[model samples]
Target: MELGQASAINFGDAVAAPQSGRRAQEPAADATADPGVIETSIPFRLDDLRWSGFHTRVVLALGITWVLDGLEVTLAGALSGALKASPTLRFSNLDVGLANSAYLFGAVLGALGFGWLTDRIGRRKLFFITLALYLTATAATALSWNVASYALFRFLTGAGIGGEYTAINSTIQELVPARYRGWTDLLINGSFWLGAAIGAGSAIVLLDPAVAGPDLGWRIAYGTGACLGLIVLVMRMWIPESPRWLMVHGHPDEAHAIVAEIERSATGHDRAQRAGTLPKIRLRMRDHTPLSEVVHTLFVTYRERALVGLTLMIAQAFFYNAIFFTFALVLTDFYHIPSDHVGWYILPFAAGNFLGPLLLGRLFDTLGRRTMITFTYGVSGVLLALTGYLFSIGVLDARTQTIAWMVIFFFASPAASAAYLTVSENFPLEVRALAIAVFYAVGTGIGGVAGPALFGALLDSGSRVSVFAGYLFGALLMVIAAVVASRYAVAAERKSLESVARPLATME
Candidate 1:
């Protein structure tokens, strides 16, 4: 075993050797024991990704997905006033709900469909295909001639959006360092809503016509979103392949190549030490395995992990879908804010959105997964329900509205990022992408369809105040999700991804 570099591990001096096959925590781990002899804090080939960098890319990608999603859905929000006022569109509250939901119903199909695509094909390759498809979908959304036509186009767009939730999250977790994974993933996830704020904010600004005649604001907003997605296609080129996936799927050489490049990135930086330290370093490359074996590893032995992904995804999509679809309507109809100032009011949501990952992410590790996520779900729900109720009761003055909105935004923040971290950490390298996609796709798809259906009914039949109570139910779902998470969710950050093992999962 080669040793004695300044960062090298000293076998005799280090703690008990790490067990075999435990995944590397961070590439920045001070030293490594060979995988055959020990497992904790092993090194990865690439070092530049700083787990944070990996998260940054994921956040950026999801941000685009979320922006496009917000854009696609906002067709309903942005044009609602017009649709409601115009006799031609003949829109009703129920119609609006169904239109909002149609996209989500399509997303349900999209998530499952794309999950299969990610699993069968490859994560990195599938990203471009999904993005391009969504961009085309977004552009086409601007051309809808009727409610049914609009709903059909939106549904297709939802599918592409579904692909984004699953694929980008899976890729980021596979590529980033473990130390900062939670923090970064949460930050990235929060940016999805920030993208939403962008979508709506842009809609607010672009509502005026450039050439006079009819107001082309909503269409222009969709166009801007589509163009931004095209820009995303170009930006994604810079990101490298997943080192973990390369290592697990018969690409050890490629994995090492990525590892070496990352190592070069680490040459000048300070190394992050592991808790209780380990033995001297030895570089031993791992055995290559077929994709079939990887697939079996996840579905067969790691079903519990899959459940975690699936359940949490459900919670995230349910709450998020409900909030995003309804909030704009709530602001305009219940509060009666002028359409122009609505976007400015939502800009603060960006603040709450950005804050979740940057600040609350630390609690995932510090407070531990069970405690933090449970609290996150509980608190966010309470706050959101209150925000809804406050808006309904006229208790929120303008300043108070922003404050309450900020609070509610903070509540919405954690699930987006926190859940991704959970999904990624729960599965092994071979099927990391697949697990993430399945989890998000199913959750979002299910939630997307159900949330709007329920809310739309409330929006149509009764006092507008009842709609906030419906939001309360959505928040309550998070509490249930928290229970599921507490019972089923394993602590991924405390351990390495490779260390994951279910009750019946004995390694060969």
Candidate 2:
């Protein structure tokens, strides 16, 4: 129950104790005290198994992080006008932008901080803890009496979701079978759009003057997000720690037990069908991997791969943040669409974003990571460039512009989701969570922060050419990232994580 302490979690009838407290003072070579080394072929055993009811539970529980994020983002965009109109908060247009920025800043910090703990403490503990933070903070947001309080609550909410990224994404990647990894990861990430659509639909109802007053409507919207977080929290409690994480941390007995239970759940009495498939591996179980070794793993041992991840992350962050945050402003300002009606347009856009990942996910495994990453990023970039050009020339109206955006994002969403998938899978299991945190923090800090600020300024200028130029800049970044991915993207499709980047402590 306490922070930084290990807790035992129950999964069905089996219980596994996650890593507890600091192992910092322990010597790495003391094999007898902490069980020196384990070489695990256990993960491959999982890779060979067929999909089951267990996998479904894991995906549904873990995948909601993205959905909650999408929902929050959509709500923020849709309710901007409502917030500005409210007598209670009396927020300005710029204030809404600042609140969003605060949330992102908090998320970046949360990812780094909780990400380190996820690698050090354990996965199961962090997932629910982070969700609780989101639930508490978002519920508090509904009670905000001023702009400052609202922004503070939003920051905490973002922090909770941001932490979820490191814990959930790493856990899912480690647990799911390699054959289904691409599709599963894409589906989970794309589920964010499902949240986005829900938020949009909710906003249309909540923002109506007849249904609710301006002051109460936005408060209810915040409460709705909090309620969803509570639901995810209950589901997350049913999930367990990553067995792969257990094996790396010198608990192979516990790891094997957990995997055996899953196998039983997956196979029932048919366990003998794949009874001998697990491979034996030897890995040195140090109480902790030194910080220097983590740095070496990410930047030194895998420098080129690290660059590819950074490029992809920065480009995608810029593209999504720049457009998504300012989408409503563009709709209302440039095309004269009513403020309250923007949610209707967002629904179709979210649908396009969701479908891209669903339809194209399998190709990441079938066609290969390099080809698919390039095609998606490159195609999306070109489409965005052309769309921006059309808008600048004054040939498109609100309906046509929305249609163009839907098409551009149909490809862009999957490409963006792949950026998360790429970084999470590229590093050693020892530092997977921290590595994801580093890249996410760095990428979101640089591109995510700058994108909105840059576009907000451009959008405010009300110059068609200026805003058009911002879109081209985003497009150019995506093209550059696609080129980087082509050259350095790991041939990781359907391969085990250990194979993609061998664990640092792998012994014989």
Candidate 3:
């Protein structure tokens, strides 16, 4: 069978059979057994999902960080009206959007800066530092007496979790086996919104103007986020550094030791026997290649790769920011609803955000990266176009509009997630962090910041015609993103991550 083409494999397939039931009972036998816990899917399956073992605890830890991510992004929109009610803050709509941007700026700097740190120091240490920064900032955000203080705290919070985009994505990318990478990343990534949904729910009941007092509700909303950050920090203490990471950085001994530790844990054995578990191979990451050569090679080495990474990133950043944020505007303006009521409308969108990644993620390891992107984005572009037209004209009522947007957002989320999984897998570990940094810094950082900024400007213009025009602009960008993807993306579907890292030219 070819790499992605095998007997039924989904996210929840049976790649975990014991090497003989005998091996199943022995702890030391785990290393030699199917260490496939990192990723279990193989060939292809109809329902793809990812389950973590080595970093299962760490995945939970990252999920908590995302809870914070969801809380902040969703809260501003969810509680905009409540915020406006505050006598002390006197916040404006654009001011709220800009605070969101301030958060993105911190995220931008954090993604680039901490990504370099991931390469310099290591994933484990940077994880603690970044988590702490975001946690402290989140707590401070809840205490802001004025908008400036709020924005500053939000920015710092962003800077801290900004490292999360890299730490969790890259760490999981390296730790897992190739077969299950697609769905695993998607599921883990989707957890961000699970937290967001929780945040949205929290705001409706707790921050509603009718219930909690004016300023107190917004403060409590953000303070809940700060608490979640602290819990994630505590959970992270258990996760070890990546063994693959250890191997490449000339620590074969430590790498072996951790691998053995995992083996001992899995097969059920003594910790004493887990010592000295790594293979005898030591990898040094130094190559005399010039900086220009590395930059040139990312494109020159594979034109298709460059296209895949860039287009998918652009499409994801553009559509997600546009759709997710703009929907809030629609709720606030078109529905003419109160801030807390916006939470009711947000459920559909949030549900979509939750499912899309889960559904479409499996295709990366099976149908191939190219087919998934082309198919997913192609469908997603159509969905977004329909949604805009539905709202721009009076085709649907406010409630219907919410439902339509939900369907589109849910379906589109998976394709967006594949972009990250594809980019992370394509690069060798040596340059993996760099590739991720550049891609996200441009896509998530710049694209994320601009989509809202640009759309908010269009929404402010006086004409009804101008309003529809803004959505049209977003539709056009999504179409452009899909077209670019179709032309440039590579079909790295069935290939192992290792094989993907080594180009066809190299294989040839």
Candidate 4:
């Protein structure tokens, strides 16, 4: 076996041994004699697994985390005015903005803490634990008596959902076949918009005086978000752990058993068809890798890819948080649209976002990653600038402005979703989840925190030019990101994760 240079390590020739048959014979019981390094080949059978109801079930069960987050964040934005107007909790506009920031802050911390644990322990354990945290905090948020309590619960809720991003994205990438990975990730990430639409509609009725009083309606909204998590948890219990993670952790037998089970289930009792071929893998396992080595792998070994991931994450985070968090404010303060009716505008905006991924995701697999990602990011950024200009010059009313937003985000949504896919797929399996958390933290911290606060202040200033400037700033970031991606993005549309970034376990 020959290890390529550090600039780009090649796994092509690193498979030191290969057996003739589809499955290797069971190893000796004393295979764990020395824990320093253990070598084995657990076939990459998952890449070839046929799509089935099991895949659909897993996508829905695990992917609901994003939906819950979307619902939570959107609910907060929609109900900002109501929270301020409430006799029980009179939150200021800045207070409402701070609460949103608190949630994002909690998410950043959760991603860092839970992300490390996900890589250290296992995806299955952390996912269940994180979801429980989210459900508890969200349900508690419903009963908050004041700003402090609401902010605290919102932070805790963000923590749970933030942790979900690390665990869920890594799990989905490892489990789904390479061909389906692109579409699956884009659609799953895009589901956040579905939740946004639902949250908008819920706030509409819940905030109505006839439907429920001002005091009670807001509390019910928070409680309702918790219900979604409970249903997902039930479905998640039945899904198996990632075989890829198990294989690299020196449990080849367990990994093999799970993969075999998946194969059988995918084929459904077909005797001959069940014996499909899988990629014979060679993994060199280490009990623990120092943080220094992990950092080296990301920044030194695959530096270009790291740049691409960071650019994608930061750009999308800033663009999304800036607009979505402040959107209701724009409608209410600028256009005089009623808070309750804000849901009506959100429905169309959410539809455009949902359709972007559903419609454009397949092209990612066919046309390739770099081309499509660049196209989406570039187009969206350009359109956003045009929309911002229109808004500044008083050419766009509330309706036309929304139509413009719908058009802009239609391209941006899939591009944003692809940013997640980029990070998850471009890193090695050992530190995949942590890489996601690190980039998500840095990107969201810088972009997410600043974007909302800046825009909120701009909306309050009552100057069209100033608010338009905020939009241009976000637009510039996305365009810069597109340029970076064009140069550094990986052409990893249909490739297995191993092929894209070899497992840290692979060695000469």
Candidate 5:
């Protein structure tokens, strides 16, 4: 299918037909008709297409990043005992906590640096770069000879995964249809639990003295993620760059071709003929958005949305990181649960986390974003407070404690996933990736970085009261974020990206 010939439409005018024939080459730096100022229906056509195998491929390939992150985190938590027992580098409770913090700190820096580049460059390029870093760093984690070495490798691994969040979330939001965006993003983010489950299961066998021994088992676990990263690299080659991104970045012809190809693959024919009736958006193409514009867009133009995003991200970061990073420590220190058996407890917890999104994610699209986000966050906070109280009073045993956590996280998982969803979709296209990175970095730095260390110190005290205090703090943050979301969160359900937040480069 050919794009209709370029028409003499005025600036800000909507061209009813697909922009004419493909240019022999990309537009010159100053050219307007060939690329710069052409109006196109790419976004509308993309959102209108039916889901197909192509969408499935994209989900499987890009969605795997969360799984890798989950695996890394769970291994860190579950391997706390093995690290302490290792002859080469025996770790204290504080050492384990510090390592986890190092990873989060790395993620903070990675998100900021790569997120800026994702916006300046393109999504497709960053995917490989981040994955390669993750693969190399995780493998190196297996070779660490000391606590400092281990922390450094974990930090690098965190950076890779952190970068993955910006690029993958941005691409997913841009590629998915508006109707499916909420559930798809939540489920993909929630897939982190699937990795958690995998890590838990691996720990059950790998950490067993008879199977692999303490040191060998943990090392192998880190190596597993590296192997998985290699597979992910191959799978990503088939995915294309975001057409919405291309459209506003002076590649309308390439954008048109990609949309047309997606149409043929998804519908078995070019849908460009029907595009004449679809709505068109005019964009002034540019090489990149200036940092000053991005700052203004987030703080001045969309300040309220920025506040909501930061609150959600900060709350979830603390709630998840504080508890999850030190899960095995609590089990071993308080209840005398063996290190190898901690995975059994995690499996149930991971199940609850994953199922929450799978079951409730559709509601974000149906019941609406504000209403659902408020409900999930409130429920999770209340449950955590109650659970923390029970544990403080010595009323819960190892089995019962895990059961309580399973129930609490069932609500919290989707709540956490929604934080990412909120930040990624609420910003304009040009700064979308960087905005996510900034919120994640700030939130993680403030809430995530210190959580595990704080909790680790609490656990070391052996005072249930001290631990309960930490839980209460996290619960409070969640409750506050829920209230803020109810009052200010965007009701962005089932809306196109352009409608939710217009592109910064839009002509009119």
Candidate 6:
């Protein structure tokens, strides 16, 4: 497995071939014509591809980013107890919140910077850069002696994960066929809970006084992410650059070669005969899209979709980050659950989160995107409100509170995953990655960055009412976003990316 190797074989046949012994005509040359103009059916080819072992590999290699993020977040939450009780670093609730905020703030910046480059450079190139950064930062996190050092390392780690979101999401969207795209994307994004489960299990063993004391357990937990990252780097070497991206960026020959290779792997022979019937799209190739055009496209050309993406993203970001980041604090402060036992509660919670998308994901493709997204978001919001009311009144113990969360997030997990799916798929190919970054940055900046810190303060006050107020606000945002999504989300299920949103460079 090397760079440019045909790792994730996409669908469909090669470029449209000649019919009845007549060769296809190239774009006619004119003085005013764009020199890079060419016709291709690469998008169709990709969307028509059947699922194969190659696609499975791509899902495993690329989708691991979400798992790593889940692990990081869960560890942060699970280890809050250890961090606070540490002899070397006694972090207050506000300190923990600030650290979590710093990680998100770094993610916002990382997504903006790396996402811009993901669109500029090829997706394959950025994969290693982001993963390498994550590996180094997470490894360094094990060496932190104080809160400042820990926060700095965590910020760097977040930067890497944020960059991974843009690059990996773009690649998954481009490579996966349209029929399987919705469920595939949801399941992959939801795989984060798998990592959460792993982290919880790891915390249980590592934090145990018999195995390793509080100080060493948290350090070892951070080290595990770096080890997993190394394995991911090797797996990614087999994945080639996106053919549709290549075809649009003046590399039609390379695009054709990759697709042909994939077809051979998929069908044991080139289905060149069928190419004649496939539709073609003419594009004026460019090295990169300008920032001005990117801004205009997001805000003006697709303003309505942009609004929907923003609302969904902001609502989910706050809803998830506020509660999950401060999960242990809530349990410890209100319920008096010991730090070591937190992992037991997290296990059931993680199971529900993961199962949400696994069980409900197909409905997004079948019942349609708008219907599923709205239902998930609305249900999650309503459930959170009910759970908050219970918590505030002291009617729910730790066991009951964990049960409540397990039920609530069964919907919220898919709702959160849908936010990423919506943003990545609704935009044009030229700006897809950047669109994800912009929405993620803004959504996280406003909702994610503030949510944890605010909740931490509310929890620090030791007042159930204050925490309930925060929960209510998060619920309100989710409901409002659900309304917006119902009204405006693109019904992009089972449609080709090009058909859903026309490419910017498409020539009439």
State how far residue 193 of model 5 sits from its true place (Å): 0.5
| Candidate with maximal lDDT | 5
Give the residue spans of candidate 4 off by over 4 A. Answer: 1-43, 270-277
TM-score of candidate 1 relative to the true fold:
0.79
**Per-residue accuracy of model 5 over 374-405 as CA lDDT, tens digit each:** 99999999999999999999999999999999
Q: In candidate 1, residue 416 scores what lDDT?
A: 57
Q: In model 4, what is the error at residue 278, expressed in angstroms?
A: 3.8
Point out the worst 10-residue segment of candidate 4 by lDDT.
7-16
Segments in model 2 whose C-alpha atoms lie over 4 Å from true places: 1-34, 270-277
Every candidate's lDDT: 0.63, 0.84, 0.65, 0.83, 0.90, 0.89
TM-score of 4: 0.92
For each candidate, how many residue pairs have backbone atoms clashing (under 3 Å)? 10, 7, 10, 0, 2, 1
Per-candidate alpha-carbon RMSD to the true structure: 7.1, 6.2, 8.4, 4.9, 4.1, 5.4
Candidate 1 lDDT at 355 equals 79
Q: Residue 481 deviation, candidate 2, in Å? A: 0.4
Across residues 50-110, which tens digit of lDDT does each residue of candidate 6 receive?
Answer: 9987789899999999999999999999999999999888999999999999999889999
Compared with the true structure, the alpha-carbon lDDT of candidate 2 equals 0.84
Among residues 3 or more apart in sequence or in different chains, the pairs in candidate 3 whose N, CA or C atoms overlap within 3 Å are: 9-44, 9-45, 11-48, 11-49, 27-267, 27-268, 256-277, 256-278, 352-410, 368-493
TM-score of each: 0.79, 0.92, 0.83, 0.92, 0.94, 0.94
Candidate 2, run of 10 with poorest lDDT: 1-10
Candidate 6 stretches greater than 4 Å from native: 1-34
> C-alpha displacement of 47 in model 6, angstroms?
1.0
Tell me the lDDT of candidate 6: 0.89
